[model samples]
Target: MSTPPASAGTGIAASRWRHLPVGALETVRGNLEDALLAGLLALPVTFAAAVLGGLVGEELMEPSGPATTLDLTSRASLAAVAVLAVLGVLARGLVIALRGVLMARALAAAVRAGTPPTEVPAPLQWQHAHERSDRAYRRTAIILLVILGLCFGVVVPAAVQEPFLSGLAIIVAGAAVLGLIALGIPLTGTVLRRRQLALLGPVDGHWTQAHRIIAAGHVLTGDAVAAARAGRPERGHPGSAARRLGKVATAVVGVGATAAYLGFQVVAALAFPDRQRWAGGLPGERADLGPEAERMVDLAVTVCVVGGAVAILALVVGALAGLAERTQEQAALRRALVEGAAPPPYPVLQRYLRRRSAPLLRMVSALVGVMLVVGGTLVVLDGVVDAPSWGSFAGAGQGLREATGLGPGILGLALGVAALEVALASLLEARERRLRDAVVQRWPVRPAPGG
Candidate 1:
């Protein structure tokens, strides 16, 4: 092993990174400062929304009786929710902006000193996505703050504890809805003030798009490599037409997967709480039926839930695999022609790994959805069904109990279906990879000098 570098040299190098201290305390402090900045950017927007909401609202401060319930669910409350939603969007953008400043500055420093720029995962670098840590913390914090304010302060004092759940749910749901809008506002904010980077692809980060990258690569390659894209036919070819078909097919699968999952849920909603009675009335009322009848009811619910889950998983996996293939194909083409790099190998494990991640995320979202459904079911049942608490039995060990109870068996089936989706996703991924590799192997990046 080599000897360690001297302490004096280490100190000299460390001087630069001292700005972003590599310690736990530093992280806490950074988050605090970042959160503060994010809050300031969001608070004004939220306060304005609150003001607007109050204007149209029936009464900002009032005790609710039976008669006032309809008025409480008034237009003003909706307006206030809208305002909080906008504030959440601003806060998310601010968090990203702060982090981007830190990252860009760090890169600029290294570049000035003749060093490599700081690099991170492409997903984190994605300008539009909201799932990244930098964005999530900011987003969740803003929503949490709004919920606390309205629920604890306004709603509770007014003797309407319902606002706590209603506000929290509203914020969560609003954040999800605004995610798409937040992405677009950064593009060209006229009414929306954009203090963040444009919500485009990674091409915006290093300053410029694909064509510029192409020009730079050709120059760097000494004119040896020419550019080609997934679409737009190459100078000479029948194969180009064929390639478009594959690209189009990949896109179609993505759309289809999204559609199938939606359709399945709509159909499942029709099945109801039990075959005997449709939901919407007194759902929780206990039936005077025998144990055998309950058992049958449980079995039916499990079947539908599991079966629907399977369909969702298959569609999701298939869709993602298709997307991954198209992305990799375009990237490979770029690198092969522009940078003169050989196409990378697409081992089965890689495809499997890529597909497995999606199922995991889907599992997380599904877990949350299931918890809400189960908990809410239990709550509603307390009022009507007169059965054992379903929400009490959840988690890994509780799985079998849930199946026995019939409430959880549906979830299990869903999970089983998800597994099938993973398998299908893997298969589709492998096929897509092969298609790209075949095309890459045949396509000549550089033609011999004079034909």
Candidate 2:
């Protein structure tokens, strides 16, 4: 309704960077660049250490324990492994640090520029993570939808032919996702920059939907002040910054994770110095030494660890698989609409559906998580609670038969139950909301899209 003074926008942008003195932008950028460098430098070494990769960075000195002379004549190899483990630790620290630096830089930039940032607001961040939680709900909704056109939909069912290959597929799928993000990041930035001028918002925090374009413009400046006060999606502010940080963080984390694995191996090796050569149980050839129960326990631990890894990967897939479904189904709908077929249902339906399922779904998710933890804890407890006497469980070998087996079986069952719980709760919640709509006087319901 009125033309604001020219100084208004300038003041808003200035408020974004009160800490910025002379060349603060340059400083922020340099610090960010250095953090990125630290991340890159740390990656390979961290990964090597994590994987127990024998590629050594140092020579082994004599260890104080009996492990010093156990079977491996090469202390050199042992030292090399130790060095790798240390490297992994260092890399992990660097990665987290780098990610923080990236976040700070992006926040700083947004503050200076008076533009919004992209990270979902804290309130809705859960749903923004998309497929991160519910496998069953996504499966029920997306499977039927995605399957409508076999040509576009066959990949998922086709991949089920071999469960072993599914992990590799998940990893590959993750990589492709990264690739798409990489491709889109710059394009998104370009779109925002071009549209910057058309957008304008009051510098104050009071503006709502009527002020979105202005908020979008403020977000573009990467100005933290406007961003915090702004309501619209921060969109571009941290997107690029986050991308840079992720690479650094992943390398760092990979190293730490790999080092943990190696440490476990070394610990195991040390515990059973003659593990490969020594007969497992009944050292003196006693008749009562070996038992099937011991064997059962060992199997459990092995399964849990292996299953945990699978669960971790599945977690990633479960987290991302929703986004994939979102993207794929959205794409399919677009195609159908383009083909002049019965128009695909309103795209908003999918979003609302997800939004609506939010609470009950989250409850289910929490339920499942609790279940997994309880189950896994029980398994781990059983192993610790009753490890058979050394040399008693002859065929089972200490830990080889008992500890590993018992730990995982219980954990696996818990995970499955957890998954089921999240799905069922979501379904129930949706049903309850619909039935209670009249009685509740239209208590606001979340859409299935979450945000």
**Top-lDDT candidate index:** 1
Tens digits of per-residue lDDT for model 1 on 1-451? Answer: 1112111332222111101111222222233333333323333323323232322222222433322322322222333334434544454455443544344333333334443112111222222222232444445555655654554454333443456777667556555644544454443233112222233223244333442233223221212223223243343322233345545654654454444344433323332333334431332333454566544544443443344444445444544554454455455544443554432332321232121222233333334333323333323322322335433222213333333344345446534653454454444444443333333223312211220
Please, what is the whole-model Cα lDDT of each candidate in the order they appear?
A: 0.36, 0.33
For model 2, residues 369-403, the per-residue Cα lDDT tens digits are 33333344334434443455322223323343344
Q: List the residue pairs that clash in candidate 1.
A: 284-384, 284-385, 285-384, 285-385, 306-413, 306-414, 310-417
- List ranges where model 2 is wrong by over 4 Å: 1-293, 316-324, 336-343, 346-349, 352-451
TM-score of each: 0.30, 0.22
Predicted model with the maximum TM-score:
1
Each candidate's clash count = 7, 60
Predicted structure 1: clash tally: 7
RMSD for each of the candidates: 17.7, 22.7
Structural RMSD, model 2: 22.7
The residue ranges of model 1 lying beyond 4 angstroms of the native Cα positions read 1-98, 115-144, 147-150, 153-303, 319-451
